[model samples]
Target: MLNAIVIGGGLAGSQAAIYLADNNVKVKLYEMRPNKTTGAHTSSDFAEFVCSNSLGAQSVTSASGLLKEEARLLGSKLIEEAYNNRVPSGNSLSIDRWGFSKKITQIIENHPNIEIIREEITQLPKTPTIVATGPLTSDSLCSEIKKLTGEDNFHFFDAVAPIVKKETINFEKAFYASRWDKGNADFINCPLNKDEYENFYNILTTAEKIPLKSFEAKYFEGCMPIEVIASRGFDTLRFGPMKPVGLFDKRTREEHHKNYQFYAVVQLRQDDKQADLYNLVGFQTNLKWGEQKKLINSIPALENAQIVRYGVMHANTFINSPKILNKTLQTKFNPNLFFAGQITGVEGYSESIATGLFAGINMLRHLRGEKLLELEAKCMLGALLEYITFANHKAFQPINSNWGIVEKPQEVEKLKKKSKEEKGALLSNIALEYIKEIRNGYFC
Candidate 1:
């Protein structure tokens, strides 16, 4: 029987352990929390979401959502737990962080085939192992990784958004609606008139910001703090995250939000299943606590909003994957050692979970003397693996799921002029078909 060691209890680590255990492989899962904690984590729960509680868009036609769907089809325990503990977030799959983590921890602790080791791993494991210690990998283990990867590892700062009590929000000004009504009216939108938006923008751009450590000051483009985004220009945020497109003032019977334009809008998604808390969407920040409260109060309807958590930033480390690991996430120098999660250059919670699944499945395949499986490039998981393992090594950066990385199918290419949604639908169908084939041929 095959046995494996999985390091860390983050999303990726938990996922890898579950996969191995379900496949009859004995797994020793190590989590260095509640014993020796990462400064960012507050609990000893498995798969603690230190950042946003969202898992990104929920449409299979979208890249991020497709990755989640792929994991679900493959029986991802964390994804199942996420759905069970889901919160309202329109077209996104957001979960109650505490409940979500607790559920996974309970299940992992009780698994017969899995052993939970609650201690910090000071060095790399010698046996077959999946090193999924995420971005906040311990310093000593990082040193061991450096010796293998040759010091080409990179680090970037990731910021978290603040969450507020639902009752504290002034509902008179904050209306309920999804971006385009794609899903339920799950988002609480606070609209800003031109003057209101201008005042808020001025204050936000000039707000007191937190200072990052000198060695860990670089920010990832995908997770740029709201203040950093606003610094670009007056309309920078308007065009980027705070754009008022696809949303309208519900107080008026507006025509599909396309006919009218607003200055800006701040959206909050439900942070818990009870609908008692909601997190500011795309409002990740590294501002001082006082400044964060002040900045949030400047927005319409949020003047008395009670913040449940303050936004903070931390360093996320990822290796130059293309140069260090193969498409299967196995290190070139050490075949027994595999990498996953944010550390492998795949960003976002769902992407990290996808990599863990691949690593676990491939590890099982390696032990079974079966050929390793690789999904077609038309699939989200396949595109992500290709990008991380085959992209330009020198210029490689951590990547999130995006259609740009997906390879177009021949049928999709034949279409002369297709809308983005139509193309996405075609690509999604192709990807799912490939996944079905994979399940039947390999997983079955």
Candidate 2:
């Protein structure tokens, strides 16, 4: 029997292990926590949710949601477990962090073909292995990865958002609505008039920011700190992430007010199924907790805001995927070895799980002496794999799954009258059908 070793028991590693074991492959899963630790994780459990419990949008029309559905159809262990433990949070799939991790750990431990090993792995195994060490990978393994992939191939630093408990929010001043009637009005909009926006902007610009450690200075472009966005220019944020276009306040019903479209708007997205918490949309920051509360509360709607968690920035690590791996997620240098999750440069929980499933499926193919499965680019999961393996090597950065990366149908593009969501739904349906075909073959 072929044996597979999966390093790091985070979301990616756990998923990889489960899929491999389910296929009748013997697997060893290694986790370095409780023995050693990262700056982000607090528990020793496998697949720990370090930041937020919410996985992302739950609508099939949204890219994140569509990815989740794709994962579900593929019999993704992580998504299945998450769904069963899901809490109510509007249209997003959120889980209890502690409960989620505990459940995953239990399942992996109970699997007959899988063995859990607790120790810090300083070196890679020469035998077949999958590296899904995620962003907060330990220092020693990172160095080993650097030697194998080359110095310029790895990265470190992640901009994270603060999670707030639902009970803490002052709902009297907040209202829920998706922008322009999109996605079931799933987001909570915190409206700001001209004066309120200016006041909040001023505080944000002047508030104290958490300084980067001497060793970690450069920030990833994709996950820039909110303070960095503010420093670019006063209106920089307004034009960038905090832009208030496409949203109309039903309470105000003043769509064309011209001047007060919103000096700015801070959106809080539902973080769990239970609506017990909301994450500040596009508000990832490195501000001190006190400063975050002081500055964030300056907004009119958040004057009485209560913070359950504060935004933090941490060092994230990844490999130069385009130069190292094939679409099957196996390393070019070693066919027996595979890579998955953030370490492979794909971002977000769903993206990580997709890579894990791909690695798992391909690993099974290798063991069974069958041809590897290479999905079509039209599929979202397939497109993500293609992107990581084929994006420009020098400019390749970690990417979250987005519609912009998916291969668009020519028929959809030609229709100018269709809304973006309309086109997205059509493409999503096609992708799901393709995934179903893949699943049918595997399940039978």
lDDT (Cα atoms) of all candidates against the true structure: 0.88, 0.81
Candidate 1: tens digits of C-alpha lDDT, residues 1-444? 789999989999999999999999999999889888777788999999988899998889888888999988877888888889988777788999999999988889899999999998888878999999999988888888998778657878888899999999999888899887677898998889889988998889888887777885677788889998998889999888788888866677455444785779898988887899988988999999999999999997999999989998888788888888888888888879999999998999999898998999998887787877776678999999999999566677888999998999688888759887888899998899888888888867
Give a tens-digit lDDT track for model 2, residues 221-310. Answer: 656778888889888888766788766677666656644455677787766556677778778788888889887777666777778778
Go through the candidates in order and give the C-alpha RMSD of each one to the true structure: 1.9, 3.0
- Using TM-score, give the best candidate's number: 1
Deviation from native of the Cα of residue 236 in model 1, angstroms: 1.0
TM-scores for all candidates: the values are 0.96, 0.88
